[model samples]
Target: MSGHLDYEINKELGECYLFMGELDKAEQYYTKAASSNGVHADPYLGLAAIAIHRGELEGALNMYQKAHKVDPTDKTHAGIALVLMEQGRGADAFGHFVEALKVNPENMVALFSLVRLGHELNRLDEVVPHLSRYLEIDPGKSEVRYSLAGCLVCLERKDEARAELNRVLEGNPDFEPAKELLAQL
Candidate 1:
């Protein structure tokens, strides 16, 4: 069989084992897949996931870096950002999340993380645009709309915040948080 075919088979096996919670089996197949092909990032991503599951943060970071080097995709950037967040490197994680969003604007994980990190770091200005984009993609998410309203309130954009709160209340009339926020506004 061709090396690429072998790599695909090994990678599939690794994923199956990982899904079944067989870490050792998954690791073995993932390692085999990594050696089977020198170009694809899936094996490294799989290994990174295993490392994360095992609490080997440094190993997971290294594996994610390797995956990113191979394929600089949004998934790799998001993985690195998540690991950085776990390490308490919020600033660094924020940057990676931004990169992930730039690479794929529809990346909800990156968007949500960026919004959360932005709020925690008091960078509401940076978060507003992303939150708006998220709402565009998922208008039914009342909680996100509520969060956007809270961020707007912090920015003193009362009119915009009130609009968002109204939207949330319209979607879910019993959403007390939105009702409270609207009343405050």
Candidate 2:
């Protein structure tokens, strides 16, 4: 119980430091947290964040993978995918991002990264459903709606794209991209 408490306190401190952009302090606390409770993934995730901030992609990937091994949470998968993407392994990262989304459909990091990768991979068709799911949860997100519309346009489903763009314009009239897309459609 004491060890669990120690882990919790250290992990929280790590998160606070990370949020404050004190990467060194955060890493120290995260390391302590990991020592206190090896089963928890948060510490490794925090460590991975620090590694990424320091531009140590290999170390970040290792930490992320360690977290995933401890607990295959959405954050761990996303973190691993992010590091892999940075290492110019987008093809490999794509599967991990998809796994992250599957674990938590609302993971915006995984969702947005997948969208960006979809374009690079020319897998717009695969990204459409993920974008649609995100929009269902966050209907007010004009950017996500715009992305969905863009995907539809690329898929040669201009009618569907027009409908999505119209919805975006309805919610945010000043959205230039939506207006331009709507006009083009």
Candidate 3:
């Protein structure tokens, strides 16, 4: 088989392990893939995700930066922003998240991170609008709906928030956060 095929297979296996919560196996395969190809970005991205899961934010940032340098994709930028946020650099993180969104406005990760950062900064107006845009992109995502409800509540839009919360509950009958908010309402 070709080296590129081996690299692709290894990268896929790495992603599978990462999604299955097996970071060690994921990292091993990603490293193998990256060393094999050194041309594709997926291996670097998989390694960065493993680093993030392992709480090695600096390593994750380095890997993600390399992925961005290799591919210049929105996913790479979003990954960097997420790790930066995990490292407690909220302001810097938000900037990269915005850049990722500007690169791909429908990036769910960037949108979700924006909502989180906006809320943390007490910028309810910004949060709600971002959530609204997220909804436009993926109206069926229950988590985004829940977040939108939270943003609405923060903005004192009680009725709209209640409606959104109800929508969340329609998908997940036992959604504790929505249940709690409904009780307060």
Candidate 4:
């Protein structure tokens, strides 16, 4: 059998196990794939996901960083930031999230992290701009609209907040959070 075929089979097995919630078996197959000289970062990414699911934030970060080194894509940066955030290193998480956004502005995970962290840090002003960016990229995402509305309300922009909340209700009239926010306004 070709080395390429072995690598592919191992990586796919790893992903399958990971998605099935078998982290240890998933890691074993991922390690096999990574050791098989595969060209892609799929095995490493799978290992990182397993580490994350098992609450090994530092291990996840290291695996994600290694995957990034292998692939150097925007997703790798976002994955690293997610692990950092899980470890409660918000400032460091923010930086990696920014890097992911710089590489791919449409990276939703990175954008969402920035908005959530900004709100947590009492930087409500930052939330609007990031939310605006997300809305521009995915205008039909009602969740982003709701978040934007919440941030606007926090910043004392009642009219704008109300408008966005109305937009959210237009999509999902039964959305309790949107209804609750609207009632507040």
Best of the candidates, TM-score: 2
Q: Report model 4's TM-score to 2 decimal places.
A: 0.85
lDDT against the true structure, each candidate: 0.91, 0.91, 0.85, 0.85
Tens digits of lDDT, candidate 4, 17-64: 888998888889999899995567888789888887878888888899
Total residue pair clashes for candidate 3: 0
- Models 1 onward score TM values of 0.91, 0.92, 0.73, 0.85
lDDT of 3 by residue, 1-185 (tens): 99988988998899899999998998899999989945888888888877777778899899999889889888988998888898888888887887887788788889888988988877668657667776787787788898888888888999999999998888889889889988998
Error of 2 at 161 (Å): 0.8
> What's the distance in Å from true for residue 91, model 3?
1.1
Clashes of each: 0, 0, 0, 0
Is 1 or 2 the stronger prediction by TM-score?
2
| Model 2 spans with C-alpha error above 4 angstroms | none
lDDT of 3 at 46: 84
